[model samples]
Target: MTAASFTAGLRSALRQRFRTLALLPRLLHSFWQTSPALSAAIIVLRLLRAAQPPLVLFIGKLIVDEIILQTASPAPGPTLADWVESGRLSAVAGWLLLEFLLVATANALARIGAFVERVLTERHDNALGVALIQQVASLDLRDIEASSAQDRLQRARTQRFMGNQLLTSLLSQAQDFVSLILFVIGLLSYAPLLIVLLLLALLPTLAGEAHFNAKGYGLNVSVTPERRQMDYIQIVGSVAESAKEMKLFGLGAYLAGRFAELADKVHRGNRDLAARRTLWGSLFGAIASLAYYAAYAVIAWRALKGELGIGDLTFLAGSLLRLNGLFERLILGLTQITSQTQYLDDFFSFMDLRSTMVAPSNPRPFPVPMRQGIVFDKVGFRYPGKGAWALRDLSFSIPVGETLALVGENGAGKTTIVKLLTRLYEPDEGRILVDGIDIRDIDIAELQHQVGAIFQDFVRYHMTAAENIGIGRVGCLSDRPRVIEAAQKSLAHPLIETLPEGYEQMLGRVFARGLDLSGGEWQKIAIARAYFRDAAILILDEPTAALDARAEAEIFERFRNLSEAKTALLISHRFATVRMADRILVLENGAILESGSHEELIALHGRYAELFALQAAGFQ
Candidate 1:
C-alpha cells in the first residue's frame, strides 16, 4: 500500500471506531427497555464480582506472610494438635479461611451473573425482533420494492440475531473493566512503572485489533448481496413453491452450484482476513508476554536485595501477571465492541427510515358512499429508475353506481392506475380525485378502507381457510357470519365445506395438514376477500382468469347482480366478461382509443369492436 493510501485507510478506521462507540448509549437504552430489573441486577452482580478478585489476591499475600512468620518462630509443640492449640499458626489459619470464603463467594457470584445475563440476552433478542418487524411494516411499498432498501432490510434482519452475543460481550467487558481498575490501584502502591510498561506493550495489539475489525466488517458488507442470493437459492431448492419445477427441469444440481459459488466467495474473503489477523495478533501477544516477565524479574531482584519482603515480592509478581492479562483483555474487548457496533449501526439506520408517502396533518375524511366517484384528471406517472412513462395524460372517470370495464394489453398501465388510485405510488404529474377531492388530501388509512380490490396474482397464504378470507377485513375476522356470507358470494363456500376441517382447514402445501387447492378454487377464495371487505368502491383485475368458461360465466353473472348498485371498476382481457359492463373503455398505450357500451362499440367498429370480434371468432 502507498503511504497516502495507508493514511486514508487509518483515518477511515478511526472514524468507524468513533461512530460505533457513539451507538453504545442507544444499546444501553434498548437493554433498559427490554427489562429494567434484569439490567439493574446484572450491573450489581458484575460489580460485586469485580471487587472479589483483587481482595482474594490480597488475602493470599497475607497468608503467605503469616506462614513465613510462623515457620521462623520456635516450635510451640511437637504434634499437629499442639500446634493448633498454641496459636502459633492462628494468624495463618485465619487468612487461609478468609481466602477460601472469598474464592467461594466469587464463584457463586460468577454463576449468578451468567444466569442473569442469559435471561437478559434472550429478552433483548426478542425485543429487537419485534422492533424490526414494526419498522418494516411502517415502510411504503416503493421503499420496500427498492433494491437499496432491501439490502438495508437484510442487514437489519441479520444483525437482530447477533443481539445476544453483543449483550454478553458488553457485560463481560464491563466486569473486566472494574476488575482492571482495582488491580491498577493495588499495583500503584508498589511499582507504578510496571503499569506504564504494560500499556506500551499492549498498544500494538490494540491497533492491530482495530484495523482487522474494520476490514472484517467491510468484507461482510460487500458480500451481503451474494449472501442474500445464496439464501434465496436455498429456499427455492427446498420449498414446495418450486418443487414441481425443480423436479421437472432437474434444477437441483444447478441451484446447488450457484449457492456453492457464492458461499465460496464469502468464505475466501473471511479466510484471508482471519489468517492475517491471527498472524499479527500472535506477534503482538508475544511482545506483551515478554514485557510482563521482565517486570516480574525486577520485583524478584528487589526481594533478593532485602529491599522488599517475600510477601511483597509475591504480591507484586501476581499483580504484574494479572495486569498484563487484564489489560490485554480490556484492549481486545474494546475492539470487539467497536466491531459489533457496526451491526448496531445497520439496525438503527433501518429503524430511522420514514415513509415518504405520509398522510397530511389535517387530512380530509374519506367519502362515505362516494358522491361524484373517482376521476383521473390528466394524471401522469413514471416508475422509479425507468425512462418511459407508465401513464401520461390519462383522463377518465367512473360515475357513481356504474360498472366500468377497462380493456388494454399487458403494458398499457392498467396496474399502475390501481397503484396510483390506492396511493401506493404518487403521480408524478396531475391529480387523482376521489369524490372530487384530491386523493393526497384524504386520510390514507380511511381512503384504503373505503376501497376494495383483488388482483390477478393474489397471495396464497399458508393459513386457515377462514383466516385467508377474514384478513380482508381484519376487524371482522371473528365474524363467522360475514366470512360465510362472503365465501358464498364468491361461490367458494361449497369448496371450503368439502375440506376435512371446513373453514378451519389450513390452506397451501407449505405446512403440515394444509390442503392445497386447484387454481380455480384458490381464485374463488381470493375473490371472496373483496366481498368480505364490502367497501364502497370495488375493483376486480382479471378476477376470474383461473376459472373455466362455465365458472367464469357464473362468476360474472353473480358480479353483475351484486354490483348493480355499487360503483365498480373491472379489468379483463375477455370480451365475454367486459360485455356485462354498463360502459367499456378500450385503452392502448395508456390512452383511450375507444369508449362505449358493448353494443355501441360494436356498432362504432372501433378498436374495441376489432378485439371483441377477434375474441368472439375464437369461441365459434
Candidate 2:
C-alpha cells in the first residue's frame, strides 16, 4: 500500500505482462488439442466476425451517401407510385436492402459461434481437471503437505475454474484486435490524427487497469494461507469427518465466529482496492470520451465547410466510436490475460515438480520371496524442515518369517521405523537392505507392493463396506470372496454381515442410508483392509489402538495364525501383546534401547522390564 511498494508492483506487473504474452501460444495449443474441430470452428467464426463490423460501417456510409444524393437531385416524386414510375427509388432502396442482409447474416453467425464456444470451453475445463489430478497423484507426500505448495495449488484451481470465461476473453481479444486494425485503416483516410489521439487517451486507462490487477493478484497470493485455513475451518465445522468431535466440543459458535473474522478481513481488503480502482477508472474513461467527441466535432466542422460530405462525417464518427471501444477492450483484455498468466505459472510449476521418491532408471530386480530378511545399516532419518532426527543411528534386523514387536511410547521412532521400512520416507544416512540388495535400488512400486502396513491413524473411506476393505488390495477390489475372507480373518465379518446391504452397505454418515461405525469397529475394517493385501511383509502399527483389551488379544491371535508363514512388524504400547512376539525391541528417542526375547528383557529388569512390570501390576 506504500508509494514505494506500489511503484515496485507496477514494475513487476509490466514484466509479468510481457512474459505472459509469450506464453499465450501455449494456451492456444491447449485449446487446439482439446478438440481440433471446435478449435478450427472458433477461429473461422472469429475471422468472419472481425471483418463484419468494418463492413457494416462502410455499408452504412454508402446508404447515407445514397440518401444525400437522392434528396439533392430532383429525380423522385413525392409519392412512391410516381417515384416507381420514374424508376428513381430503385437504386437507394436496393442499397438499404444490401445493408440489412449483411447485418442479418452477421447476427446468425454470432449465435452459431456462441454454441460452439460453450462446448469447447467445457471440454477444455474437464481436460485440465484430469491433468491436475494426475499430476497431484505423482507428487511426493512432502510436496503435497507443504503450505507453499497448497497456496500455489489454490491459485491454480481458481484459474482452472475460469476456463469458460478465459476462452471467451481470448477469442474476443483476438476479434477486437483485428477489428481495431481495420477501423484504423478506415479512420486514416478521414483524419489520421484521430487514431493517434484515441491511442493516447487509452494509455492512462491501461496503466490503471494493470496496476489494480497486480494489486488484486498480490492480495490473493498473500492471503492464500488464510484462505486455505478458512476452507479447513469450514470443513471441520460441517464435514462428517469432524461432526462428532465438533458437537462434542460445542464448537459451532466458535468456528462461525473465527470464519466471520477471517472472511471479513479478506473482503475489506478487496473493497478498498476496488474503490480506488473505480475512482481512477472513471477519470480515465471520461478522458477517453472527451477524445472521441473532439474528433467528432472536427469532422462536423469539415462537413459544414463543404470539405466533407454528411455521409463521411457520419462514417467517421461511427468508426471513431467503435475504434474507441475496441481499443479499450484490447487494453483491458491484455491486462486480464497477463494477470491470469500469474496463476498459470503456479499450475505449470506444480506440474514440473519432480519427486525425489522415485525409482532409478535402471532399477535392480526386487527380492522375490525376500530370503535374508530386512536390515538397517547405521540408518538415520529426519523429516524435511525439521531440525531433530525422527530416527538416528538405528541398526537392526527383522529375520525372515519372524514377528518383531516394537514397544515404545509416543514419538519413540517406532512409527518412523515402520515408515522407513515401507520406503515412505528414506533415511538421511546409511541404507536399508532387503536380502543384501539396497531397498532404494528396487522399483518403488514393486517395493510397496510387497509390504502392507496399517498405521494407527488409518483412513476410513466413505465407500461401501466391501470397498473399504478391498482398497488395501486394489487388484482384488471387485473380488467379493477375497474381501469376505479378509474381513473374517480380521474379526470384522460379524458386524459387517449385520448391515442392511451386507458387503455393499455404504460406510460413514456422509450419504443417505450410510452406516457410521464406532472407533473400534472402524479399526476392525482398517485391519481387514491390511489383511486383504496378503503382503509378504505385514506391518501393524498398533492397528488395535482403538480396541478393548479382549478385542485386541483376539485380533492379534487371529493375525498370528494368518501370518505364521509371513514376516511381520508390530508396534504397540501394550506389554501383553509385546510378550507374544518372537522378539521384543524397546525404542526411545528414535533409537533402540534394548532388544531380546520378552523373557530375557524381563530377566534383565531394564527399561523394558520396568515398563512391563508396571503394566502387569496395574492388572493385579
Candidate 3:
C-alpha cells in the first residue's frame, strides 16, 4: 500500500478500536448509576485482590526461609505431636499460618469482587436494554426498516452477549495489572533482564491475539445481515402466527435447511479465524516457555554460586513464573476486551443516530380544538433510498368534521399519505399543515396524539383484551371502565364477552392459553385501538380489510357517530366503503387524479369509475 492509503487504513483501525473501548466508560457509568455502593465495593475489592498474589508469594518465601532456619537449629522432640507440644515447630507453624491467612483473605476478597461484578453486570445490561427500548420507540419507521440500520442493530444486540464478559475482563485485567507491577518490582531486585526477556518472548503472542481479534470483529460485522435473516427465518418457521401457514405449506424442512446452510457459513468463517489464531498462539506460547526455562537456569546457577541465598532463589523464580503468567493473562484479557468492544460500538453508534423528524425547539401544540383541519399543501415525500417519490405534490384538505376517503390500488401511495399525516415520516419537499400552521413546528408528541391511526399492519400484542385497547391510550391502560367503553364503541366488547375471561382474556397465540381471534374479530379489536385514542384527526389506513360486509358496515356506522365531532380520514380499496365518505380522492402515480363525491366520480367515468365498475362486476 502507498503511504497515504496505509496511513488511512491504520487510522481507520485505530478509530474502530477506540470506538470499541469508548463503551467501557459508558458501561462503568451505567454501573455507578445502577448502585454507587456496589460500584465502590467492586473497586475496593479489586484493589485488595490485586495485592493478594504478591503477598502470598512473598509470605511463601518467608515460610521457606523460616523452615530452613528451624531445621538447622534442630528439634529436641521426636514425634510430630511431641514436636508441636514442646513448641519446636512454633516458628514454622506461625509462618505457615500467616501464609494461610493471606491466601484465605485473598480468596474471600476475590469472591466478593466477583459477586459485586456480577450484580453490576446484570444492572448495566438491564439498564441498557431499557435505554434501547426507549431509543427504538423514538425512532421513525424508516429508521427501523433500513437494512444498514438492521445490521447495526444486530451488532448492538451482541453487546448483551458480551455484557458480563466486558466487565469481568476489565476488572480481572485491572487486578492482574497490579499483580504484574509488584512481581516486576520483586523480580527487579534479583535480575531485571529476565523481565525484558519475558516481554520480548511474549510480544509475538500479544500481536497474534490482537490481530485475530480484529479479524473476528470484522467477520461479525460482515455477517450481521445474514445472521439477522437467519433469525427471521427461524421466527417464521417456529413462531405461533406462522406455524399454521408453515405447516400447510410444508415450509418446516425448507426453513430449517436454509437456516442450517446460513449458520454453517457463519460457523466456517469463525472456525477459519479461530484455527489460525490457535496455531499462532501455541507457537508463541512455546517461545515464552523457552524464555522462562532459560531464565530459570541462570537463577539456579546464581544460587549454586552463592550470589543469591535459597530464599532469594525461591522468591525470584516464583515471581518470574507469576509475572509471566499474569502478563500473558493481561494481554489475553485486553484482546478479548478489544473484540467485545467492537460489538459495543454497535450499540453506542446506533444510539447516536438522531431522527430528522424532530420538532422545533419552540413547538406549537396540535391545533387541538381545530378549525381548518389537516392540509397537505404542495407536499411531497420519497421513502429513504427509493429513487421515486411515494407521494408528490399531493395537495388535499381533510376539512374539519368531514369523512375524507382515500381510494387507491396497492403502491399508489394510500398508506404513505397516512404515514405522513401521523408524522411517522416527514415530507422531503413542501410541508404538511395542521389548521393554518406547518406541522414541523408542532410538538411531535402532541401531533401524534392528535392523529390517532390504525395502519393495516398494526401489531397484535400478546396481551390481555383490555390491555390491547388500553395500550392505545397508555394513561388509561389501568382504567378498566374506559377500556370496556372503547371496546364497546368498536363492537369488540361483545366479542370479548364471548371469551372465557372477557376483558381479561389474553389475545394472540404467542402466550399460553391465549385466544386467537379470526380476521374480522381481529379487525374489530384493532379498530378499538383507534377508538380509544384521544386524537382529533382519526386516520384509518385500510384497518378494516379483514372485516366481512355486515361487520364493516356496522363498524363504519359506529365510526361515523364517533367521528361526527372529529375529522376522519379513511383509506380503503373497497368501492362500496368509499361511497359513504363526504368526498373521495382518486390517487394514481403519487398525485391526485380526481377529487369529488362518489356519485360525481362515477358520473365522470374516470379512473375511479373504471375501478369501481370492475369491482362492482365481481358480485355479478
Better of 2 and 3 by TM-score: 3
C-alpha local distance difference test of each model = 0.88, 0.87, 0.84
Worst 10 residues of 1 by lDDT: 1-10
lDDT of 2 by residue, 1-620 (tens): 57787678788889877876665677778889999999999999998999888988988888888788878878566788998888777877787788788788889889999999989888898998999898887677667777777887887777776556666888899999989899888888789987889889998888888889988888888888878889989988988778778899999999999999999989999999999999989998999989988978888889889998888887888898899899889988988978777666666666678777867878987777878888889999888889998888999998888999998888999988888888777789999998898988988788888887899889989999999999998888999999999999999999999999999999998888899999999999999999999888999988888899999999999888888878899998888787889999999998999999999998998999899888889989
lDDT of 3 by residue, 1-620 (tens): 25585356445655667667878898677668888998889989988888888988888888788778778876767779877787868877887898888889988887777777887888778888888888888888899888888888777777655766777788889989988998888788788898899888887676666666777888988888789989999889878778788989999899999999999999999998888778878998999999989989999999999998778888988898898898789877887887788777777888888886865989977776998887898889998888999888889898899999999778888888888887888899888888888988988888888877888888888899999999898987998888888889988999999999988899988788799998878878888988888679898888679998888888888888889889999998888789989999999889999999999999999999999999999999
Per-prediction TM-score to the true structure, in the order listed:
0.95, 0.93, 0.96
Alpha-carbon RMSD, candidate 1? 2.1
Ranking by lDDT: 1, 2, 3
lDDT of 1 by residue, 1-620 (tens): 35686457667887999988888888889889989999999999989988888888888889888888888988888999889889787888888888899889989998998998888888888888888888887787788898888888999999876667778788888888898899899989888998999889998888788888899899988889998899899999999879999999999999999999999999999999999889889998999998888888888888889988888787888878878888998899888889999988888889999989867888998888677888999999898898898899989999888999989888988888888988888899999998899999998888888888999998888999999999999999999999999999999999999999999999998788999999999999999989999998889999999999898999988988998767899999988899999999888787788888999999998888888888889889
- Candidate 3, residue 365: the lDDT equals 75
CA displacement after TM-score superposition, residue 360 of candidate 2 (Å): 1.2
Instruction: Record all residue pairs in model 2 with backbone atoms less than 3 Å apart, i.e. clashing.
Output: none
- Number of the top-ranking candidate, with TM-score as the measure: 3
